[model samples]
Target chain A: MPYVNIRITREGATAEQKATLIQGVTQLLADVLNKNPETTVVVIDEVDTDNWGIGGKSVTVRRKQGK
Target chain B: MPYVNIRITREGATAEQKATLIQGVTQLLADVLNKNPETTVVVIDEVDTDNWGIGGKSVTVRRKQGK
Candidate 1:
């Protein structure tokens, strides 16, 4: 069984987009590793911009700083 | 910064339990890898019984079979 975790900054991804992502990641694992899609698990986590940081600054602040 | 993804079977974990897990994982990463907890990302994925499988059998089916 292959478990895939995807993280993205919360930007209001539609349910359809999430579904597509789940499907595509499952397919990619199956094609590359010959894993069974039925046994593959894909979970998506959407983090708030304030909670997600890079280079010691939150994404929200970084974006505001035009970085 | 360390990004940690935790996967567990969906068994109705309480909000407190999840919060504890997130805190513990963040602490572990900080202690062991010297990562910054403020920048550490810990996302927990609780998989459905039907979507999580082992030995080619879903957890739901396996549970039903008492396996």
Candidate 2:
């Protein structure tokens, strides 16, 4: 079984979008690696902007700084 | 910076429990990998029983079968 974890900065993704992502990722794994979707696990985690950082700066601050 | 994603079957983990996990994982990465906690990201995803499977059987079914 292959487990897929997707992390995204919380920007209010609708349920439909999340469903699409889960389905697409599952299909990709099945197609590329011959994994069974029935046994695959996909989870999506939405992190708050303040809790997610890049280049030593939180996404919130980076967005404000426009860099 | 290190990103850690933890997946577990949805068994009603308390907020405090999740907080402990986040802190522990972050500290582990910082101590072992020399990662910065401020830039470290930890996300926990609780999967439903029906969506998580092992050996071609969903957790729900396996639980019901007592195997």
Candidate 3:
């Protein structure tokens, strides 16, 4: 069983969109990796700005400072 | 290019253990799927008791009710 984990930026995508994305991923894994969707697990995490970092900066602070 | 999403039990693992698990998963994906670790993204999500389900029931409620 292949378990897929998706860490999404908070407020980037709606819950419905996330669910659909997971379903699409599920299909991709099944078709591409020859895995079983029943056994495949997909988790989408919403990371807060402080919890996420990019370009050596905290997303929360950068956004607040309008950088 | 392969993204792996792992939805973990909220309290089932410690942060260190989770990190190790992610590393292990990264290795496995590289070996089995021939994916690159740098490009492979693994996301582990800790779910609250009320949010998880199994065996047609909520894991949180079942644990609380001791069922």
Q: Give the candidate number with the greatest DockQ.
A: 2
Off by over 4 Å in 2: B1-6, B9-67
List model 1 lDDT by residue over B1-67, tens digit each.
6876668888787655666666677777778888887778766667899999999999999999988
Give a tens-digit lDDT track for model 1, residues A1-67: 8989888989799999999999999999889999999999999978756545454445566688897
For each candidate, give the TM-score of chain B: 0.90, 0.91, 0.81
Worst 10 residues of 1 chain A by lDDT: A50-59
lDDT pick, better of 1 and 2: 2
For model 3, give the interface RMSD: 5.7
lDDT of 2 at A47: 86
Model 3, span B1-67: residue lDDT tens: 7788776668768888989978999999999989999988889867754434332234454576685
The alpha-carbon deviation from the true structure for residue B54 of candidate 1, after best TM-score superposition, in angstroms, is 0.6
Complex DockQ, candidate 1: 0.08
Q: So what's the TM-score on candidate 3?
A: 0.51
lDDT, candidate 3, at B8: 61
Cα-based RMSD of candidate 2: 8.1
Fnat (0 to 1) per candidate: 0.04, 0.14, 0.00
- Model 1 misplaced regions, further than 4 Å: A1-6, A9-67
The order by descending lDDT is 2, 1, 3
